[model samples]
Target chain A: MKKTLFEKIWERHIVDTLPDGTTQLYIDRLYCHEVTSPQAFAGLRERGLKPFRPGRITCVPDHNVPTLNQDKPIEDPVSRKQVDTLEKNATDFGLAYYGLQHPRNGIVHVVGPENGLTLPGMTIVCGDSHTSTHGALGAIAFGIGTSEVEMTLATQCIMQRKPRTMRITLDGQLRAGVTAKDIALYIIARMTTGGATGYFVEYAGEAIRQATMEERLTICNLSIEMGARGGMIAPDAVTFEYLKGRAFAPRGAEWEKARVAWQNLYSDEGAVFDKEVHFCAEDIDPMVTYGTNPGMGIGIREAIPSLDSIDEAGRISFLKALDYMGFRPGEPMLGKPVDYVFLGSCTNGRIEDFRAFASIVKGRRKASGLTAWLVPGSRQVEQQIRAEGIDAILTEAGFALRQPGCSACLAMNDDKVPAGRYAVSTSNRNFEGRQGPGARTILAGPLVAAAAAVTGKITDPRTL
Target chain B: MRNTFTILTSTCVPLPLENVDTDQIIPARFLKATTREGFGDNLFRDWRYDESGHPRPGFVLNQPTYKGDILVAGKNFGSGSSREHAAWAITGYGFRAVVSSFFADIFKNNSMNNGLLPVVVSPEFLSELFASIEADAGTQLTIDLPAQTLTNQATGRSEHFDINAYKKDCLVNGLDDIDYLLANKEKIERYESLVTSYKLQVTSK
Candidate 1:
């Protein structure tokens, strides 16, 4: 049968097809973090069984680990125990670990790319939802649960049901002032979060063709928000170029062979998809989220929409969103007060993101009433920002450059918006209280984050 | 305890929204501890409990009439950060399964591997389940794993569901990947030795 690249990889990984039409899939890699692994390891211990493919499983401590402290034991007892447990589990289980102060230690997603562990035509699973961040390298990556973490650790393969496929092709040059982050927000806004349900989406377009790897990751990283099981882009020169000199990439003559193999990872012409959506990049602007969901967003210039225009069935949804967000109908999101501004996460926290923010905030100070925290996604990102003078620029502008972690994005650590405070963030989700209880988050790009810091309002970066 | 797989059809509580995230399932505040117990009570903690930790009257789970082991949710259930506590809370709270038109990749995998079934039904079937659950909170459903069908005994209608064969095998036989590998340790040892020898050959070459 004719197949897409997705089909070929999936077919190669299929262990069996069940009586009920679900295929038993095999996992290639299992990535886990400190927070979710302890219970899973205990589950394994209770069963008196050891990991089957320890070499294929890797562990990292990110979520609960404070970004700043490296030399000392974790201050919080609970967090200390979580990190300690991961180190012990990884050690006892024979899995590779990037413990704190390990040169490679960083956010799991960032480490995956930097290590060349996320390769073309691979299946990657992590006990972290943003595992889709690995898909930027043309791998099929999805987040798994702690039990599935144990499953992969024990067997190196996870039982699975394949999702249907969706292809979202955006084919035009983007307008100025719009970055890949805007493109992703635009796609989610159009797709309504559930649009890609039960599907793995492949993003292909002229705009994507021009996007740097960081941008591809930014798009794929948010696939979960659009209701995709995950998202991927086929490997091309850009993929090979990014991997050529990486630490884990194939070397010498082997590199040539790997490139040849990767070239075959693209979707074939006339491939049939379960669903397809298209967008013209020209239509997208510097998009920012309005209500509590990633899907509830608009171009920066647009006003917050009134609920009346939607279908009657959607009125409750619109009203619920407004109630949760304390939003008024037909009000422009511009000049909306913000208590905080966050500039980090798996989304938009790379070196490019920092450069964008530093450029905007270099000469200007953060808004007097607002607290701006700029966190790098990885130590590498933080190092680059510091080396490139981005951190200095931020510091001079009254923005504190936080150490790297998934800080304030989900409030997994100390950085979180307090109850009833409004924040402008560059993270993926803006769900009600995603930053903290009753913490209303408006998702925007880094440029907009800087703008929110400077103006203390959810203003358009383009207008800045 | 002998590992047991009891096929249970959950009584549905209607949660009507797409993309219900992990934070909504079990908030971060409830996940602070390394231990997994006590979280079941705090499942959907902020939403389920009022500011003083009193039960919120408007919350769906608190509505006295809708009681059951299964939760039928709208599309994109369990979306957001990979918080396994969401699954733990659901399972700890005694939910045997979750029926949804779609489950986020991470949450579904977590649910299935942890012995909590994530039953994916067609949207049409999901709507029917929601309608039945809403119209009659006393609705009792049967999830037959061997049959791969979710049947509403009251309505006498069954929706076909799918589970991966390996998961089905393990679930029925109560064999996790570790248990299965242990049962075939000889083959694994041989494969490991083979990999070791292969590396030696490559290095020598």
Candidate 2:
């Protein structure tokens, strides 16, 4: 049978089928962070189970660690305990742990690829929704709940009912100033939040193939927002080039063998998918989310949809979302003043994202009215910013790059947007209180975030 | 551990808002705790209470008229985040099941794993369910796990929902996946050996 890339990878990882018809899928890599892993670790302890494949697991403390003052102890008692618990669990299980202040310490998703522990033709699972970010390397990666996390820890396999496959083809040259973040927001808006539920999406066509690895990672990072089991792109020359010299990537002759093997990772010419959708790159604009969910987005220059545009069934929720966001239906988002500008998360905290932000803020000073949180995804990315002198440009623009962590994206630390404030965030989610209680988030790409930083309000990046 | 589910009957709390993400179910700041207990106190924490820690009577849970073990919500309930804490909060708050027209994939799985049933009804049926509850807060819902049926007692309307056969079995028996995988450890080891040998051949060549 002619198979799609997802099917081929799924087939390779099957250990056995449970009588319940679920596949016992072998996991090649398991990434853990402080927030979700504590319960899984506790479960293992309760069952008196040891890690089946300790070598396959990697742990880091990102979600709870403060972006600033990482050298000091975490001040919040509960947050401190969670991070301490993860370190204890990692030590107990004999797993590789990148603790706070470690050179490789960063967001689980960001550090995984940066160190090359993420490879093509593997099955990766993390206790994070953004684990789909790793699927850009052509792996069958997805988020799992804590129970599944514990299952993988005890057995190195997860029980999964194989999801149907969907192929989303975005074909055409992207407009100038448009980005992978815009492409993601564009797709989610067209196909609402639940559009891809129960399907593993494989991104294909011109736009995806031409996207850099970092861009591809950004695209895959938001797969969960569209309700996908996961999303992946076939490994190609671009993927190989990205992985060539990374720390955990294969070296020398092993690299040659791996490259040859990975070359066969794409779908067969006549492969079939459960569903197919095509999008034109020209249709997308530098996007911004106006309402609470990721799907409630519009092109930057467009107005919020009128109530008549929302179906009767969704109107109540639509109005409720608008009320929560302090937005009026049919109003333009172009000049809405914002109070904070956050430029980091697994979704957009990469070095390329920093570069994109710096490109727009090169000569412009930040708007004095709004506060800005410019955080990198990883220490490596932070180093790249300094090495490339992007830091100088940002400092000149009156912005300071903070330490790396999942800062303000979910606001687990002190980097929270104050109550009732409007924030133009480069994070994946804009849910109510996601940044902080009573905090309003307008999701956008790094470029859009940069524009908002300089103007202190929602502005079209293309115009800036 | 959650008790096994066979049949659950209870009044329903209606939240008509769409895309009720897990973040709203349990906010990120509340997730700093390492343990899963006491999450119910903070369930829908922001929505149920003000920043001053006072209950907002306008919210459904706080209203004297509405109280229930079943949560009926709008379409696409539990949309964002893979945090199982959302499921923990729902179950911890004593909700045996959540009814919606649609559900996000990870949230559904998390709910099932934690024994919180996610009942999906047709859009019209869900609308009617909401209308029935709005007309009176005393509307009752009965969910039969074995038969995979959800009945709105007030309207006498029942709908067949879908649940994975294996998952249904697990829920009925309160069985966990880890125990089953442990019993099949030999199978996993054999598969790993095969994969390792295949990789060895590629590297050597």
Best by DockQ: 2
In model 1, the Cα lDDT at residue A406 comes to 77
Please provide, for model 1 over A116-227, each residue's C-alpha lDDT reduced to its tens digit, 9 standing for 90 to 100. Answer: 7678888888877789888888888987777677766666665567789988999989887788889999999989877776788899989998899998999999888877
- The number of the candidate with the highest TM-score is 2
DockQ computed for model 2 against the true two-chain complex using alpha carbons: 0.53
- Residue-level lDDT of model 2, residues A1-464, one tens digit each, is 89999989999999998676789899998999999999999999999999888878889899988888889998988899999999899888788888888888889899999988899999999988999999999999999888889999999998889999999999998999999999999999998998999899999999999999999999999998999989999999999999989878888988998889888999999999999999999989999999988999999999999999888878888898899888899999999999999999999999999999999999999999789999999989999999999999999999998999999999999999988899999999999999999999999999999999998888898886
Which regions of candidate 1 fall more than 4 Å away from where they truly are?
A15-26, B1-12, B119-137, B145-205
TM-score of chain B of each: 0.86, 0.93
Question: In model 2, what are the clashing residue pairs, if there are any?
Answer: none
Q: Write the per-residue lDDT of candidate 2 for residues B1-205, one digit (tens) a residue.
A: 4579999998999998888999989999988878888788899999899999999989998997888889999988998889999999998889989999999888988998898999999999999999999898899989998999999998899999998787888899998788678989999989987875213111100
Q: What docking grade applies to model 1?
A: acceptable
Residue A83, candidate 1: Cα error in Å is 0.8
Per-candidate TM vs. native? Answer: 0.91, 0.98
lDDT of 2 at A243: 94
Task: At residue A69, give the lDDT of candidate 1.
Answer: 67
